[model samples]
Target: PRPTQQTQTFIPNTSGGNLPEITSELLNSYIHSSQWHFIKQLAPKITPSLITSALLDLHKNPDLAFQFINHLGFRRIRDIKTRCIAIAVISGLSTSKPTLQLLKETLNSGIATIQVVFNELAVARDELRIRSSTVFDFLLRVCCELKRDDDAFKCFYMMKEKGFVPKIESCNDMLSMFVKLNRPYKAWVLYAEMFRMRIKSSVCTFNIMINLLCKEGKLQKAKDFLGFMESLGIKPNIVTYNTIVHGYCLSGRIEGARLVLNAMKSRGVQPDSYTYGSFVSGMCKEGRLEEASRMLEQMKENGLVPTAVTYNTLIDGYCNKGNLEMAFSFRDEMVKQGIMPTASTYNLLIHELLMERKMVEADDMLKEMGEKGIVPDSITYNILINGYCRCGNAKKAFSLHDEMIHKGMLPDIVMFNALIDGHCTNGNIERAFSLLKEMDRMKVHPDEVTYNTLMHGRCRQGKVEEARRLLDQMKRRGIKPDHISFNPTRLTYNALIQGLCKNQEGDLAEELLREMVSKGITPDDNTYFSLIEGIASVDKAAESSNS
Candidate 1:
C-alpha cells in the first residue's frame, strides 16, 4: 500500500494466437504493407485457419491475392512455411481460371518453392479431405509450368489416391511431362493406361508418343504404335503422319519417309512445314543437296513458311559438304525472311570455315560473334583451335588453348588430341610426349587416335624403339591399337628392320613381317624392297668374311 503502483506495459501476442478473421479489408491492409514481417507476424494471428475460406473468398477477388503475392513484403512471407501453404491454396483456387498475367506472375515467383507448397497440400490432403478439382488441375499446370516431371507424377498419384479420377486433359498433361523428361517408356505406359480407362486418345496424344519414340530412334516401334492407333479406328491426323515421317527421315529411311509423305496426301492429310523440314533434313543427310533445296521451294509452293530450323538444316548440310558459298546464300535468304541467325548458325559457319583452313575468316567470325552478343561456347573455341592446328600453326593453336583455359573453359579430349597431333606433325616429338603426359595428369584418357598420332610421329622421326614402346604401353593399358598403329610407310618399317638386322636381330624383323601378313596386311613394295636390300647387304658381309 505504501509503494507506488508499477505500470504494466502491454506486449502484443504476435508469435502464437488466434489469427483474426481475414476479411477483404484486413487482406487489403496486409497486402499494402511494405514490411512483410508485419504480415508474417500478423498472419499467425488470423484465427480458425483461414486458408481455405480466404482462398475461396479471394477467388471472387482474384486481383487481391495476386497483389499480395506481388508485393515485396508478401515475398518475404514466401520463406515461412505456413504463409507458403496459404499462398499455394490461393494459387490452386485460381489455377483453373488463371489469367495469363497471373500465370506469368506465379512462374516468376520461384517455381521450386511453389512446388513445396503443392507437396504440403498433397501431404495434408487426407486430413483436409480437400477435393477441389481446381486445386488438382492447378497443381498439374504448375508442374507443366515448372517442367517438374517427378513432382508432377507425385501430384498425379496423390490425386488418384484421393479418389479423384483424372480427366483426359490431366492425363495428357502427365504424358507431356513424361515426354519432356525423355521417359518414353513411362509415357507409353500412361498412354496404355489412358486406353484402358477408355479415355479416347486425341491426335495430340498420338503425336507426342510418336515424336517421343522417333526421337529415341525407335522408328519401328513408333510406326507400330501409329498402326495400332489406326487399328483402333483412330484415323491418323496430319500431326500423326508428320511425326512418323520425321522419325523415318531421322532413321535414314528416306524412301519410307517419302512413302509416308505420299500416303499423307492420299489420305487427304496435308503436310505441314514440319513434314517438309524433315524431308529436307533427310535429303541433306543423303548428300542430295538439290533435292533438299527443291523441298524447301516446294514448302513455299504449299504456302508453308520455312522456319529458322528449316534454313539451319540446309545451311548445316551445305557446310558439312564444304560448300560455304551455298550455306551463306541460304543464310542470307533466311535473313531476308526476317529470321535472325542464332548462335548455332554462326557456329556452323565458323566450323565450316575452320575445316577449309580459312583461319582468317574464322577469326573474323569469332569477333562478329562477340559483337552480335553471341558468346562463344566450348565448341566454338575448339573449332578455331583445330583449324589452327590443321594449318600447321601450333603457336596460334596453343595460344587459343591458353585463352580458353584463362576463360575458365576446360579443354576437352578432342582439343588436347588436336594439339598433340599438331606438335608431333611439326617434328616436335618431345612436345607431343609432354602433351601426352599432360593428358594423363589431367585425367583425359587418350583414345586410339591420340596414341596412333604419337606413334606415327615417332616412326616418322626414325624413333622406332620409342614407337614400339608406345605400342606396348597401349597394349598394357588395354587400349586396342588400330591398323594405323601397326602399319606405316615402307621407310619407317625398313628403318626399324635395318636397325634390328644390323644388330643381328634379323629374326625379329622376319617374325614381325610374318605377323603383319597374318593380320591381313599386305606389305607394300617398299617393304619388300627394304627386306631384299637388307638381306643382300647381310650376304655381302658374310661373303667378305669367308674370303
Candidate 2:
C-alpha cells in the first residue's frame, strides 16, 4: 500500500530572494558591539569575519582589495599593516625575504613598520635590540627595501652592540647591500668584521664581494678574491665568473675576459645570458663585429634566448662599425621577436648615419622617429647639425641650430665648434669671427677647438697679427695651445716670409725657423724653397747694382 502511494519530497529555494539589506554602518556597529554573544553570532553572518580576512588578504590580492580599503576609510591600516602583511605574505609565498622587501618598498615604505616591529620584538624578548638571527634577517630585509645603507650598517652595529652574533646569511645580506650601493669600502670592512667574528662566509658572500671589487674596476683584486674563494673550497658560480668577465670587459681587457670565459667552462660553470652578453659587448667595443655575431649565434645554440638588451648591444655594435644596413636588419629582427628598440638604439643609428655623411637618410630617419612617437634628444640633433656643417650646408645647419634653440635644447661646445668649422672651411672667415663673438656674448666659454678654428681662419686671410692676438686671448682664458692650436698652413708661413723678405727682414724669418726647428717641428719643403728663392733674388739685385 505504501509503494502504491509514492511520496514526492519538495526542495525549498533558499538563495533566490534579495539578501537582507545590511548598510555598512549597521554592519560596523554589530561588529564592535559590547554584547559578546550577539557580536560573535552576527560577525560570522555579517561582515566582521569577512572584513578581518579581507584586511589580511589585502597582502595576497592588493589590487582587488585596494579600492575596497580606500572606500572603507582604513587609511592607517592601508598605510602600515597592508604593506607589512603583503611583504610577509609574499615572503612566505616566495620564501625570499629580499624579493618580498623589494616589492614591499616599491609599493610602500616598510621602513617605519620594520622599526616598530623590531622595537616591539626586542622589548618582548627583554633584549636591547633584536638578537635572533631570524629577527635580524627581517631587519636586514627592511634595510634593503628602504635602500638605506646607513640604517643597514646601524642594524649590524646594533646586533654587535647587543651581543647578538650575526649569522653568515645576515653578513652576506649586509655585504650584498653594500656592494649594490657601490660602497665596496664598507663591504670590505664588513667582510673583515665577519672574519674577526669567526662568522663563516658562504659562496654568495664571496660572490657579492668579488662583484663589488669588479664594479670598482679592481679586476686584479677580484681575481685574488676568486682565488681566496677557491682556497676556502667555495666554488664560483656563474654570477661570480660573470662579474669578473664584465670587469675585464670594462677595463678594455677583452683577452682577459675571454680567459675568464674559458676558465668558467673548464670549471663546469656553464655560461648564462649575462656571460654571453658581456662577451658580445666586449667584442663589439673592440670593433670585432664578426666575433660578436658568432657569439650571438652560439648563445642561441646554447638554448639561451637573446633579450632586448642582447639585440640592442649587437645593433649598437653594428652601428658603431658604420654598417647601418646590418644595424637596420638587426632592428627588424628584434621587432620580429616582439622587442622594441629604445631611444639609445635610435641615437646610435642616427650617429652612425651622420658619421657616414648620409644627411638625407638621417633626416628621413628623424621624421620616422617622430611618427613613431620617439622624440629626438640633444645628441641626435647634434649629430645632424655636425654632419650638415661638415658638408658645407650652413643654411641647413643653422636652421637646425635655430630649431634646437626654439625647442629649449642648448647647444653644447661641440655644436658651436662644428658651425665655426664650417664657416672656416667655406672661406667665410668674417662670419666665423662673428659667431665667435656671439659665443662669448652667450657666455659659452670657448674651448680649444673654438680657438684653433678661429686662429687658423685668421692666418688663412693673412691676418697673422690678429691670429697672434687671439692666441694671447686663448692663454688669458686658460686654454692651452697644442701643435694644432698654432694655426698650421703653408700660405700663412709663406705670407710671413714674403713680408719679412720685402722689409729686408730675412734674418728674422731665419731666426724664427731656427726656433721652430728647436721645438722639434721641421720647416716644410715650401718654407725652405721660399727662403732660398728670396735670398737668391736679393743677391742678384745687389750684384746688378754693383755692375
Candidate 3:
C-alpha cells in the first residue's frame, strides 16, 4: 500500500482580507526592495494575514523580516490587527532553532544586546500617538503568553515610564503569576501600580487578591473585600464566595463558613461542590463525622456528587476515631458509586490496622492496595515499622526500615524515634545508643519526644541518674526541659512519677511534683490523686480493711 501523505487546508480570514500564499520566490522579490518601497507598493491592499504569511516565508532569515518590518513602522501599518500579527509572527519564530541562532548572533554583537534590540523595537510603537499604546499592548500580551514574565514586567514599567498604558489583561496575568508563586507581596505591588496607572480593575483581579488574603489567614479582611467589591459595583460571583468559604473552613471557622453559605444564598448564587467539600473537610478534621455526613446528605440533595477527596476525609476521620468498619464501609460506598479509592484511602486503613496491631490485616491491605494499582509510599513504610516496633519485633522493624531506604525513602526522625524507644523498652540500651549515634550521623536531631521516651524507659529500668542526665542533655540542646515540651501532654510526667513511686523512690516523685508546680504546670485533680496513691503504695502504708 502506498503511504498517504498528510495535508493541511489553509483557511482564509472571514473578513475581506484573504490569506496571501507567499512562496520563497514571492518573498525573495522583496530582498532588494528599498526602505518604505514594500509598504508604499502594498498600501491599502496588505492584510494582517498577508503580512503574517510574508514574514513566515522569510522566517529562515529573520533579520530581513525584522529590518523590513522596522522600516515599515507602526505608522505605515495603521491597522492595529496588522501590527499585532506582524509582531505575532516574530514571537512565534522566537522559539525556533533558526530564530534562536539569529538571537545568539544578534546578542553576541557588543554594539547591541538582544534585550536592547527588543527595547528599541518595543519603543517604536510610540511613533504614532494613537496606535502607540496598542503596539506595546500587543507586545506585552505576547510576552505574557510565552511565559516571558521577566520581559513582561520590564515592558509593563517601560509603558508606564513612557506614558503608554500596557494591556490590562497582561497586568492581570502578571499578578496571577505572582499569586501562584506565593509572592502575594509582588502581586500587591503590581496591583498598586495598576491603580497608579488608572487601569480598570477586573473581577478576576479582585478575586486573586481575596484568595491571597484568605490564604494569609486574614478572614475578616477577605470578607471586608467583598463589601469593597460590591461598593465598586462588582457583584460577587460563585468563585468569590467559594474562596472565602474555603478560607473560613481551613481557619476552623466553620460557623463563619455557614454564614458565607447563607450569604451566597441571599445573593442568589448557588453553592457548588467546592463549598460543601470545604465544610465537610473542616468537620472531618474536628472529628465531627455526623455533621460531615449531614453535609454529605445536603450535598446529594443539591444534586452535587461528592469527590474522592470528600470520601477520603470521612474515611480518615473514622480511621482516626478507631471506627475502622465505618471507614472501610465508606471506601466500599465510594467504589460502589464509581469513585475508586485512592492511595490515601488505603493508607488510612493500613495505619489504623497497624495501630491496632493487626499485622496480618495490614499486610492484606497492602496486597489489596497493590491489586488496586495504588503504590505504597513512605507513610506506608513508617506505619509498618512502628507497628513492628510496637509488637517488640525489632528485627522485623529494622528489616522494613532497610527496605524503605532501598526504595529511596529516607528514614525520618519519627522512624528513628520509634526504633530507639523500641530498643529501650526491650532493655537493649546499648542497641538504643547505637541507633542514636546513627541518627546523629544522619544529622536527624533528636526531638523532645525522643529524649522523653528514652528518659521514661531509663526511669522504668530504675536508672534514675541516667534519666536525669538525659534531661540535662535536652537543656544543652536548647530545648527547655518543660512538662509540655518533653511530651505533647502531661502523661509523660505522670508515668515517670508513677514509675518512680513504684520503685520506692518517693523522694524523686516529690521532686518531680515540685518541678511541675514551679514550672507553673497546674497539677490537675487526677495528677495529685495519682501522686498521693503512688506515695502511699511506695511507703507500704496499710489502708483500713473495715471498708
Candidate 4:
C-alpha cells in the first residue's frame, strides 16, 4: 500500500467508496512476473490519480519499473485514464533505441489521432483533466519530435479548445518550434489563443514572445512587450535583455542598443559576450571602430570569454577600415585565445588584400588557408575572379571559374556577372556572349547588370544592332533595365551612334538617334558630335577611294 498525499485534489471514488485502492506491491509483482493478462485486467480499476501516485513509487524498483513501462504497450486496455497514463509514461521514458522504436510502433497503432486520445480524457472533471494534461503535453512533444508538425499543432489547438490548460514548458517548446521554422505569425496567433484561454505564462514564455517579435522586425513592439512584462511582475532575465539588444543592433540602431546595455547594467544584470557582440557588430557597420574595439576590451575585462563570432566581427571592422596590420593582430589574438578562425574570418581578409591589388600576397594567403584545411567556398572564388578581372587578366579569371566548377560549386549570379563583366571590359564580346549562353543553360537568370555589360561590349565591337536586340530581349524577359542598361548615358549613346555610322549604316544611326530621343533623354552636343564626324569621315574616305 502507498501512503497517499492530497496532491490529487480532483481524485474521484475514494470518498464515495466507488473505486478500490490496488496495492503497489501487487501491481509491481504482476509486472515483474510478466503476467500481462492480469495487469490488463486491473488497468480499468486504476484511477488517473492512482496512476500518478504509482509512477512516483515505480522509480524505487528499476526492474519492475522497466517491465511496467514495457507492459504499457498493450493495445487491449479500455480505460481512458490508464491508457493515458501508460502512453504518458512511455513518452517520458529515456530508453534505448530499440525501446523507443517499439514505443513508436505501439503508439502509431491504436491511436487514430492525438485529439481522439485527448477527447477520451473526461476533461470536464477538474482533477482528471489536471492529471491528464501532462500526458497530452508529453504526446505533443512526441509528435513534434517525430516531425508531425501538423498533428502536433492540431493537438495543441485541441488542448485549448477542450478547456484543458497546457503546461507552460510544453507551450514554450511549441512556440520555440514555430519560431525556428520562421513561422512567427503562427506563434503569435497561438499565444493570443493562450491568453484568451487564461493559461498562465512563465518568464520563459515572455522571452520566447520577445524573440519572435524581434525576429519579425517589430522592434518597437518588442520593447513594448518588455514593458508589459515588467508591469505583469515578470522580471526579465539576461536572455530577454540579449534578445532585444540584438534586435536593435540588426536594425542599425546602435544608439538604441547602447541604451539597452546601460539599462541592463543599472538593473544589475551583467551583459554576456553575446550582448556585447551585438553592439560591436552594429558599431562596426556604422564605422565606429574605436568604440567597437573598446567594447571588445570591456568584454574581456568582465571575464566573459569572447566567441569566434566576436573576433570575426572585430576583424571585419578593421579590414573594412583599411587597417590590415590591426586586422592581422586581432587574428593572432584570436589564435592565442585558442579560438580557431572560421571561414568568414579568412574571406574578409582575402577580399581586402585583393582589393588592394596585392596579387602575390593574396595567392600565398589562399594557398596557406588551403594547407591549414580551410576549404574555400564559392564566395572566395568569386572575389578572386573579380580581382583578376579588375587587373585585366580575364584568362586567369576564367581559370578560377573552371576550378570552382571542378570543385562542384555551382556558380551563382555574382560569379557569372563578374566573369561576364570581365570579358566585356576586355572587349571580348564573343566570350561574353558565350558566358551569357552558359548562364541561360544553367537556369541562372541574368539581372539588369548582365545585359548592360553585354550591350556595352557589343557596342564597343561595332555590333550596335546586336546591342539593341539584347535590350529588347531584357524587356521580353520581364527585366526592367536601369538607365545604364537601356537608357544609357549620353556617352554610351555617342559610342553606339559612332559605331553604327562608322560601319556605313547611316540609316541605322538615324534610327538610333530617334530611339534615343524617345527615351526622355535630351541629346547633348557630344551625342551629335560623334554621329556628324563619323559620317563626314566616311564620305571623305569614299571620295578618296573614287579618285
TM-score of each: 0.68, 0.61, 0.65, 0.72
> Cα deviation in Å at residue 1, candidate 3?
61
Query: What TM-score does structure 1 among the candidates reach?
Result: 0.68
Q: Candidate 2, which ten residues in sequence have the lowest lDDT sum?
A: 1-10
| Residues 444-489, model 4: lDDT tens digits | 8777778777877887787888877876776566644432233354
Each model's C-alpha lDDT? 0.71, 0.68, 0.72, 0.74
**Which lDDT tens digits does candidate 3 get at residues 464-504?**
67776776776566654432234323555665676677676
Better of 1 and 3 by TM-score: 1
For model 2, what is the error of residue 199's alpha carbon versus the real structure, in angstroms, after optimal superposition? Answer: 3.8
Which scores greater on TM-score, model 2 or model 4?
A: 4
For model 4 the TM-score comes to: 0.72
Pull out the clashing pairs in model 3: none
Model number with the top TM-score:
4
Please rank every candidate by TM-score, starting with the best.
4, 1, 3, 2
Steric overlap count per candidate = 5, 0, 0, 0
Model 4 C-alpha RMSD to native: 10.0
Instruction: Supply candidate 2's per-residue lDDT for 200.
Output: 82
